[model samples]
Target: MRRQHLAEEIEEIFRCSGGTYGSPKVFIELVRRGRRVSVNTVAKVMAELRPAGRKVRRRRSLTRPGRRPAPRISSAGTSPPRNRNSSGQAT
Candidate 1:
């Protein structure tokens, strides 16, 4: 549960932060708004008033290459190690 005035501050934080600020940013914003306010109070109020962030959906590509038959390979095993150059890593 949140205090009524704290709820108003949460709304003000959302307005100033443009809905992008989560607890961390909103906490800092609250500190900036007034010297007397503490970050913990802002963080708690923001958590109750608004969601942290919206779920992000990745774009799926339906335009893929047509199905094709697998190719035959003579040896599908790892190749033999080659000589390394001046660098310590393998060539």
Candidate 2:
């Protein structure tokens, strides 16, 4: 059985954060509100409460886009040039 009151509080905080806060954040919020709960316990509670609510947003690229497009590799199915002698004959 869950601690009904703590679970309710966790749910409230999680909902307030638009379901973006994971265990760490939820735990921090709970501590901020004077709740003496461990982070691991909060994580366990969250895991049970809303398994699908934790959505990891994609990380944005730190570097800016290049001015020029990237150089494309030739896929012409051509092999590397053969080794040639000084007279241009295949060695």
Top of the candidates by TM-score: 2
Candidate 1 per-residue lDDT over residues 1-91, each given as its tens digit: 3477767876776776557666666666666667356767767766677656433479988766797768976666878668888887776
Deviation of model 1 at 72, angstroms: 18
Error of 2 at 21 (Å): 0.5
10 residues in a row with least lDDT, candidate 2: 46-55
TM-scores, all candidates, are: 0.44, 0.57
Q: Pick by lDDT: which candidate is best? A: 2
What is the TM-score of candidate 2?
A: 0.57
Model 2 alpha-carbon drift over 4 Å, by segment: 51-91
lDDT of 2 by residue, 15-59 (tens): 898877888888889899998989888888877886435567799
Decoy 1 TM-score against native: 0.44
